[model samples]
Target: MEHSMFCYQCEQAMGGKGCTKYGVCGKSPEISNLQDLIIYQLKGIACYAKPLLEKGEHIDKEIVKFVENALFTTLTNVNFDLDFHLEMLKESQQVKETLRNKAPHGNYPEAATYNLSATKEEMIRDAVIAGVMYEVDLDPDIRSLRSTVLYGLKGISAYGHQARYIGHHSDQVDQFYFIALEAINNNNLTLEELIQMAMRAGDMSVEVMSVLDEANTTRYENPSPQKVNVNIKKGPFIIVSGHDLRDLELLLQQTEGKGINIYTHGEMLPAHGYPGLRKYKHLIGNFGSAWQNQQQEFDGIPGCILMTTNCLMKPRDTYKDRLYVTNVVGWDGIKKIELKEDNTKDFTEIIDKAIELGGFEKNEKEKEILVGFGHHETLSHADTIIKAVKDGKIRHFFVIGGCDGAKPGRNYFTEFAEKVPDDCVILTLACGKYRFNKLEFGTVAGLPRLLDIGQCNDAYSAVRIATALADAFETDVNSLPLTIVLSWYEQKAVADLLALLSLGIKGMYLGPTLPAFISPNVLQYLVDTFDIKPISTADDDLRNSLQQAN
Candidate 1:
């Protein structure tokens, strides 16, 4: 078979092979090549930057921001314009060149030495050779480890971006980004060494998530239990999507008293929990479930759409014109909202559009969606949860969270959630919860049975909650009655999964399908070491989990 590009860093790679013609997330071959070139240049930048970081020399903060944005640009469905990626690649190349010149004495790899061409034709030519799989190691195991580290880096970069976005920056996290990218190119590293490095990436990710958690809570407020209204109101409204609370906050501030309501969508559902955000009465409620359901949920919506991050599908023409993208998210024809000098975006345009659209005449139905069951909120009820567990009222706990996708197999999560015994508590976050968030799970011990922690970045909260539970029980996390059933669609999920594994949390069930990046050898290593299982039938897996817990 012939192929134009090779990209397997997502769940829906073609036939478990690399994306040959185009990415399942609508990335074309040109964009794929540009993504590869961008990463290649990032590695170059790291090769030079790592040495400076190691020597305690101060690197520019802008470089760190660039690294974050460049990495985030490659996330699934985030950026699709060929010209835009080329510009990023060009900017990455210039930054890489400047860094390389600073450390001319540094023994940089071929990536650093390769000169980027100014013309588009020559750039594409260079990209073809810069692909991650260009020089495949003879050993599949070695290649697998390399891909694992690269994917993990992508996840790390994403969380790092979010952290930096909210006025939080970690030198350690920035240094690791450089070191990890530099190591990915080192040819002498053994398979064991590579595997260890991968775990370290996971370890760093846990730290990044923590930093992000603090950044979020400090910037906004600690998430608490709040019931989000899922139904839209009668007035003109704007639906803000993605996981960017900063953007949502700005939108809320700008739209206040403008007679336009603000509604959260997808991972933004947890925004209702932050007191700083929910204070505005016009910041009404959540409008939809996850990103995957946007097409149907957003169809005929009488408001504008703003994408602050990933999980944007090809906007259906029905709502495409009203869709506005900000930060790292971009589609060729979409209107882009840029931040002002003070780092706060003026959402005047979005607010104006919302008023012009003049949303639903009346809410079609009255419905409430409960979210914001994050760590503090849920742990506040820890005594009750523990008593329920001990008294046999709650039989088990399931941490079912990760990225959601559009594949049919994803129905497994919905079915699993529906069939989970009433005695079990379902802890979920990220977009994956959309599969079951709407379904009524009732209550357990006076608490909602399903807990929506926060975004994928809030995996740190889940870790904290689990560790606290284990400590309370005088046992380790694995010894507690908990199972992690994760649904993955993209690299952020990879980082979170690796973080879980790095924490020694074991026996996870990963679905709807395994990452296409995991080679058979790596898959075997994960199974043998962590007992990670690819999910089977929901019924079978539930039975097995319950039996194991007992």
Candidate 2:
């Protein structure tokens, strides 16, 4: 028997289990199954690529890039274009064949040797059964562990994709794509071995994030604390959303002095702190809140919107005509900007649209928020932080950030951030910060009580800050008087959690809900080993965090 589609890879899985007919992210079962087919082929490609790389054979860089792009595309809310998905499915099969012929022959799993059916109709049927639920009879715990590693890789691949976009490449990080991808298809692996692989994926998460962090800083300069304007300036304008700093930089350059004001939206809000980007006088303030609010936030805005990466919503008709996507982001009807043969984008179309629209006719009331507290920027004032902690002025550090969704319990994060004590410092990143970043938390010891740590992938910066603080105090991260309260929406947050867990950092709080793929036993394993808690009421969780744990 074949199923329509089954995906529990996100926080909002239908009924907190799986999306059977349609994805909550607006992915139809056809596209959903096709994405699984692509992922299935990615594993098959990895079987060859992994062994060949281990044997010191060269693999084409495109295969690696394709894998990363594939994982990112399948990430919730990134791609819903049926045709583009079909193209990716075909490419995956091609890549698998290319890799299969290059590898030395050996015993391999069904995934490694699986062949595409002769007809498109047969292929779709096979893909229907090749989804996340393919190994239906596998142990529930193994399935959970395997999905964790797979989702973590998807998260790592998002970073790897971004890292490579900015000329950063890591052989080990690239190799792990194969190592972990191939492992997921092997049902014979024990739970312990799967855990080890999960940790390795975490280690790779940290590495790829470091690669991206270096790539971003080297290209855009290290971020410094700056008050970014949050109101609209009356002029022709364009909004850049998503996590690609490179896209924002290019858009900044293109829109400069053209009488078009560029506004950062969603995750792109932190670009205002980069000296290179901030130097552009016309790079206006942010326009909206988180990605989840886009349909309402961008309603009939008289400007162009460029979605450069993930976290995109299905565009509404009111603004879809003005919506443009580049690279791997896609929706069926929106215009797309592709890189020229030289790997550079010509945003002339988007710029022209901004001019034609003659944006907001009048200026809105001005507002500002502080941003740009990445690892280096935050660590620069380490003396202040350490001294504050030592003197007991800054009582506790709460890391409250992750992806923001339209889910109801999200108010807990808002309330949590709002209720955090005056003496505590809140370090945050991602659109999840939007829930509380607008509120005034004031300054503590010359540092803003709320420290903005850039995009979701900037979890590396958060990790670095934690590690440096631990070293400064001569203790492990868990030993520090720090509490991590996170809200996860997608695979990237999964990778971030894996990174933290791999470093042996425990006693963390995770919400708005647990991922549906984690079975009760697997969740218990995580709970017992890592002490990971599903978030309770903000007040109770905060009270418990303050009164109880070490």
Candidate 3:
């Protein structure tokens, strides 16, 4: 049984085809297969937890940990180590055993047959068997849609795990995770029911985002406008990527005055805006554009790249020795900074390595990019923004943003932004802005029209600005003359879409390519309810989106 190692966890996965022999991110077929089984078993645990939540039973912290850790394990560039997966399996089994003992007669339809410690070979055989032997299989569309929701929830769980590591917790979020996970695994579900479940997942993500927003803002203070430097400074430095602010904060603290410069990369760019983080003079500006550009951007860089979360592609040989994995992001042979049981990561080794690298000898001239237009920052300017819209100076508001990928179609985002009418205002964030941030789209009413609203997690800023505009005009958000042209390459984008839908902001144009995990029925449900359409040509899509506003 020669198995393929192709995977669909991230948009950059081997031309969007499943990896068969070894994952493009260095994940072997055995590990990939085990991950799939972990997902299957996680779904089983979620199903078991759902009835308990519904029955008003207090969901234990251990079950919540299982849900969060399982989702984190499945993220791109995370958990490539087979031993890590085995450890997770053992832990999951222990949790299940405890749960089974606690509720001997509980409703665990899926759990009845789940074996947490199954070998990779056995797991792959079971996946094949389930497809061939299951009497009642979900419709392909439903499975796709459910998978979409599951993957999106996985993104949420990753963020939630990061927040929890910093001592944040939300019972509502934990309960919803169990509910959404259960919904994905249920065979008794109808298309309509699944659609409803998907919407609910979106609605719940708002709560999740809110919790995370609170966690970030309360700990770091509201992000304010900041100019980030792209030039790497002289002396040893570590480039921190992914979206874990807590980890970034700790790295900054450990490296402070230690003769090492710290730089943000990928989603970490937004860290510069937080008062707590921005105070670190050594925390330099962003290193590269989105996650996909790492191969080129990271090449020959004289430092280590500390990845706190997903969006990691396969490491190139040039810088492979310098990459460090933390939190859930893992790669074989890479030095992983293990977190204590309480989620605190010790960065003493990472710091020592940074010093050993002896980064660039000369200070690089400052290369700056503007960012930090998050909700709190934007809403602070609500009066001015509302007045500008009323004055007809800001004719159109176009939210052209999301995660970035290496796919050829993604260039459409850059072209679309470049082609936006001179009178229109473009608000962007995340790695997707790499597409058009270089273009000089002048300001409107003294404010730069091309606004970078932080990272994908800062989609909350877009939501807040839209709602504030609506409230100011005393109208619904959809009725406002604003357009959302989104480009997605990962699960964070999926979670952001759910947030938009939960708020009833419809007529979104989403693209790059439709998620391979989304089923036809689920797509139809989204198309019907949210008017979500795939991206077309830049000119055509922009014209159509603006026309709808008209």
User: Judged by lDDT, which candidate is best?
Assistant: 2
Model 1 stretches with alpha carbons more than 4 Å out: 1-3, 104-106
Better model by TM-score, 1 or 3?
1
Candidate numbers sorted by lDDT from highest down: 2, 1, 3
What lDDT would each prediction earn against the true structure? 0.85, 0.89, 0.79
Candidate 2 lDDT: 0.89
Across residues 412-447, which tens digit of lDDT does each residue of candidate 2 receive?
Answer: 999999999999999999999999888999999988
Q: Count clashes in each candidate, considering only residues at least 3 apart in sequence or on different chains.
A: 0, 0, 11
| lDDT for each residue of candidate 1 in 1-550, tens digit (9 for 90 to 100) | 2338889998888887778888888888878888888888888888898787878888788888898889889877789877778888878888987787777495568987887888877777788777867886557788778778888888888888878888887888787888888888787888899999989988988999999888888987888878777876798888888888888888888877788888888888888998888889988888877787788987867889999888788788899879999998988898899988899887778778888888889776768778777788888998998899889899899988889888789889999999999988999989898888888889987888898898998889999999999989999999999988999988888889889889988899999888777879899999999999999999999999999987
- TM-scores for all predictions: 0.97, 0.98, 0.94
**Candidate whose TM-score is highest:** 2
Off by over 4 Å in 2: 1-3, 118-120
Candidate 1 TM-score versus the reference: 0.97
Give residue 220's lDDT in candidate 3 (0 to 100): 96
Candidate 3 displacement at residue 92 in angstroms: 1.1
